[model samples]
Target: MVTTWFKKFMGKRLFDRYYKFEKMLPVFAIGDRFCVTHAEPKTHYSEKDIVNALVNREIIFNLTWTDNGQAEIGSVVRYLYDFFPDNQEARMFGGHRPIPISQNYLSRAGGKYIQIHNPSWYNIVYVRDMKDFLIYRDIFSILPLAERLAKKEEI
Candidate 1:
């Protein structure tokens, strides 16, 4: 109950902060600088899955781009949240899903803002029923690798 209300309140605030009417469409310039990546979860994945899969710990603190030595290249971040939220993540704002909260987490972790697109990583939409089970409503924030390690050093 309280969590739902808080989520809605924050969602409204975020919308007001980012929404803009430049032409016939709304624009939210995620950040001055951002990264992009694609998620290929065989099942309904969560924050941990994303962290384990995409974050290139071997790359040190590189947050902008990486050459994975695979087909993927450029505009990749050292963390998942560093990539701006997709249209679905944005549309699902105010929910308790990790993806929604992850977007907010990015901002708190010194990310400039968020971006919806990067030509380097074209958006790929997941079919509505990708997973059989319903994802539970819950808020989660996974800090970027760089920020997490920095906090540990501070301790």
Candidate 2:
């Protein structure tokens, strides 16, 4: 398996250290009106499922590694609603798919999901209060760096 190969390549000590660090990270975080995750859930997860996944190594590995682009926007919205019912304005923020630099962040299901993953895009979203937020993108620096890199030949 790729994971087995990766672990071997990394060696036991390095892999174990990285694994320990990764285990410390939260699978998801819930704020007053928003939820943040590295990637979307493939299906609606119950509260119990989320809790179990936090402690189950295999579940955490699958959630963190394999399930990218498997979750539909509708499913993600439902998951958000199910988990954060009190906040009707609840939004899910995640990144695994790279959208266009121009597009920056992709909003779906009436702005309930926001996907921001492009480093080249230099997109930053600021959450202020529970309902308001601001998005800032730096075009000035990004464009020139992109242009210079694009013109360079491979060594």
Candidate 3:
């Protein structure tokens, strides 16, 4: 179907490289003081279950494709808290729904879950080490610098 056509268009070597890069992406990632995901899980899942789901296509789909509003933020925060009781300040970051640019970002469950999807938008979260982490769009922007780099690489 479309994938077959894309593979042909990209050539075998390019297609294989793209596929390998895609596979390297995680379904969900838990940092020392934060959790990042494409979207919220439909139900509470244990750390073990989440790790196992990384290899299960159906579970991966559920983790990445589920709608944002289905799960309550408080519940998700509570579930995460249970998993990492030591990190009381741990927060969850995810993006599936495109939040309004005017809104900037949406925080639910008392600012525990942050839903940010706008390509030009970003958020800074300060962690326990007094370090700040920037969470922005999942896709890289094709800005002038990126375009210049791409052209330079081509030459």
The top-ranked prediction according to TM-score is 2
Candidate 3: tens digits of C-alpha lDDT, residues 3-116:
799787878888888889988899888777777778766566777877888567776876777675777446667666876777666677777777776655677656777776
The C-alpha RMSD in Å for every predicted model, in order, reads 19.8, 6.0, 4.9
- Candidate 1: residue 146 lDDT (0-100): 44
Q: What would the TM-score be for candidate 2 when compared with the true structure?
A: 0.68
lDDT for each residue of candidate 1 in 1-155, tens digit (9 for 90 to 100): 75466558778565555443312221111222222222211122243543453343332123222222221322222223333343223211111112331242212222221222222222222223322212232222223444667678652
TM-score of 3: 0.67
Residue 153's lDDT within candidate 3 is: 67
Better of 1 and 2 by TM-score: 2
**Predicted structure 1, TM vs. truth:** 0.15
Error of 3 at 30 (Å): 1.4
Clashes of each: 2, 0, 0
lDDT of 2: 0.66
Instruction: Sort every candidate by TM-score, greatest first.
Output: 2, 3, 1
- After TM-score superposition, the amount by which residue 29's alpha carbon in candidate 1 deviates from its true location, in angstroms, is 18
Model 1 backbone overlap count: 2
Candidate 2 has its poorest 10 consecutive residues by lDDT at 134-143
Give the poorly placed runs of model 1, Cα more than 4 Å off.
Answer: 1-64, 70-122, 132-155
Model 1 lDDT, full chain set: 0.28
